[model samples]
Target chain A: MTTLATRRQAAPGGSTTSRPARSGASSVGRPGFAWALPATIFFALFALVPLAAVAVLSFTSWSGLGDPEFVGFENWETLIADPVMLKSLWLSLLFIVLGVVTQTPLSILLGVWAAGNQRNRAILSAIYFIPLLLSSAAISVLWRALLDPNFGIPGQLSWLFGDGNLLGTQSGAIGVLIFVGMWQFTPFHTLIYQGAAKGIPTVLYQAAAIDGAGTMRQFFAITLPQLRNTAITSIILMVVGGLTTFETVLILTNGGPGTDTTITAFYMYQEAFQSFDFGVGSAIALVLVVVATLISLVVVKVSGYDKMNSSLEGL
Target chain B: MKTRPNYAAGIGSFVWLLIVAIPLYVMISGTFQTREEFGDNGPLSFPSSFTLQNYADAITSGFGRYFLNTVVVTVGVVAIVLLLVPPLSYAIVRSRSRGASFVFRFFLLGLAIPAQAVIVPVFYLINAVGLYDNLLGIILPTAAFALPICTLILSGTMRDITGELYEAMAMDGASPARAFFRLVLPLSKGGISTIAVFSALQAWNGFLFPLILTQSESTRVVTLGLFNFQTQYGINIPGLLAAVTLSMVPVLLVYLFARRALVQGLMGAGGK
Candidate 1:
């Protein structure tokens, strides 16, 4: 119920005594005060309040019903020695490393190759997007079957290489999850690159060709540079996503065979949901928020969020 | 790379296609035959003994309920998105003078705070609200989770609609509300559809919300129901794949026609 009329009237310069007639500006096009009220209330109650609830709850302790017992730094103290939580954190880091390092480069190559040709792009697009379209359950089930070295396609391929059930080993399972992450996440990055690559005027490439630039030269000079904002954002999302991956790993291994595949996000969920440790769970989740926030800030910096939009408009 | 995609490129595309398609083909192929046949024929072979019985078995075994439930949830979520996001975007763009930036940023917070971040609290909140077992529970949260992203996209797109359009409409004796309805509404159909399709897919594809929020068959969406199905009939690969394929049909049809807008929305929201 904050009065926007006075504020709108202020508008960086104006004055105290306002015109009642100009108060309409505060309403904008909304029908009446009563009309926009529910919506304003909904956004605050659902989004702002719940978000505030998380920020506040991160510092307190309550298990669904009780008056939350005030716990000082006990939750933070627990994560200091929590091995499982630590392992999950490490595992999450490992997943992010493999995904960003390997998956991104492979996708860049795939996109470069795919964009160069028009034939079957639709089919390839469908293929990549198929995994994306799938519900997470289906992705896990499909990959689970596919990774059945004796029975799955990848398993069959590994048979040729002699290591059949890669899902059995700790490193091997992590590898498989990374592979799945890449398979699913690549299409996302590829789409970005595909769009950006297409946006590069053909004239630039033609001019490069006449100037004796080869494919590699053209890619380095034009494609990579033009994809600057996208590449930065793409990597940002990959790191954040890789860190948060849950359903796939949860379904695939359940951090399994012995704590092999656990990301920070999934690990915290297990602690909160399965172990019922709301205190430590909240702490761990807060840590994740901090980590994710740092990562996003990096993205905004590297991509220069302020300029990316304006540059796109210029293009 | 510079050529007009010749036969060699066609061959390369096939290689990549095989990498992508073989697994999907196997998943479909696996659905038609029994586990033993799946074993003997291998995943690639055309089902030597094709049968619709697996599909029939899957359909009879709660698949119909699951499909109905999925439809209800998707329709509910899409309805919520269409109703909420456009207005929210409209408000954010038009109300620039009155703490509108903060209002916009408040929603933008949901962008980074993935729905997963609030799962525990949401579960608590939903249960407390007594929508715990109802389909409406999932619909509300899914809609909530989607609104921020959808609103963000629409807000950006709405901001881009040349102000001249609104000005011209107003000069024609149209009120601000009429200009918004007549000019802004029609122009934003593409962006809004993008939000609709995007939110629909997210709701459809979501596993986490349904898995944690709902507890029984009466309200189970396809993701959770399918997961439970796999657990009970782990050995019935054919039945499982049949169930998965059934779940895929509706979304697949929409995706085929609207891949462009859908992809654009994804890249836009997902890029950050």
Candidate 2:
């Protein structure tokens, strides 16, 4: 291995370091920092710069008019004492938990089921993927119309939904949000699990069947364990997606029934855009960034995703 | 190849199919009915007669303009991503400098930064630069947010180009730029198409950036237009459903024609 490495390294133009080149194979071309400069600057200007500004702006008071005044933790202090802010955090947690809990299993089942090559499964999977074609805004709007107390499906099936006022109460509103979320996102995650399930080695399943395992037993012993990585990926997406959910709450509930569904993302939009309270909004935005970052960090650490960077050694 | 049917799994999936299909049936069927008929029949009822009036009403009520704006945004975003991400990905995969890896890590960290988290400052920055209420404002940030995932996918593809290929090109005395054009571009076609589809969908379906940055009807994207249509014509269920149906037509067309590429692109978003 070392000889092969040295031979590759000794090739002319292969070395980016200052070390003297050894005589051997012809030099190989390699890209330099110049190639990466454009995207780096662009990303810094749009994403990273604004990220820093969110932190700085969180310490000041601004309402989208006049100059911002430095207030030294004032926004943070206010948010610490604010009940809506606290409750919004709790609601955000609830959204994440519900999203993962509902989406993970359902998508896994649908995915594994669809992985079969049967003609019916193929047709049904295609239909299942249709929801993914619509925008979040469109899905929310469609659901809002479809859930109207007087005109929607609930009205038609009043026996199943008494009063048919699904989005008018706290629990009712949250349920609608979760149900809509599941409807919109399950297809995409199911696609993920489908891909993962398709990749599972067939030999493992054959061996399980030879052991006289039943369908449920083979699924529990083989399919569930094999889907672990895909589950983590899907769950992380759900968490991040749930944390930043804005469109559904905006169009469907509008944080209504008295802030019942005002998750942190929606509250930030309300404070910054509607109320023009940019400072407090920035404070909320910073909290969102911190929490998202922490969660991502923990997952990366636990999953050893960072160590996957060793693939770069081949360069 | 044959075994007993899995009744439990089959039953569960059939129930989920009902859950998925009923809403879609309502939305499509509702769009074909008149407003009074729709309201009287409720969302679940079959359409008594087919009418194009709801779709016509949706088009006349600024959806045409919104469609144009969304198309522009999608094209602009795809163009920018195509120009920027491939070269960046090439560098991350082939460059040996520590700075190159650092740049890669920077974007990796960016994968965790949700657009909503920095949206307030983005709004402020767009206003400061006089790009507020402009489509360009929406294009730049939307493309920027897309870079991280695109970079990851493209680099993963580019990395699969073996070291021997580079050496073969080097033996011909090709420069890095020459090697990139000749070697990287052709091989990474799959990755390029994936990113194009992914970014185009992002721009097409984008709601938050346009919602915060641009306000006027002239600049409204389809998603925001759907939003405003809902608020302005809250009681017009048929028209609203028609608008929702219209917004998905382009994607549905793509799904029909390019289903494999679209599905591969979306699954790439899972970072495999």
What is each candidate's DockQ, to 2 decimals?
Answer: 0.38, 0.66
The list of candidate 1 runs beyond 4 A from truth reads: A1-40, A60-67, A149-151, A154-158, A161-163, A302-315, B1-15, B265-268
lDDT for predicted candidate 1 compared with the true structure: 0.72
Please, what are the lDDT tens digits per residue for candidate 1 over residues B110-208?
667766666767777788889887888888888777777777778777887875455445446666568667877888988888888888888887788
Mind giving the per-residue lDDT tens digits that candidate 2 earns over A62-168?
99977778999999999999999999999999999998889888999999999988999999999999999999999999999999898899999999999999998
TM-score of each prediction:
0.88, 0.95
Candidate 1 clash pair list: A149-A155
Question: Per-residue lDDT for B52 in model 1?
Answer: 84
Q: Candidate 1: DockQ?
A: 0.38
Best by lDDT: 2
Each candidate's B-chain TM-score, in sequence, is: 0.90, 0.98
Error of 2 at B84 (Å): 0.3
Candidate 2 global CA lDDT score: 0.90
Off by over 4 Å in 2: A1-28, A301-315
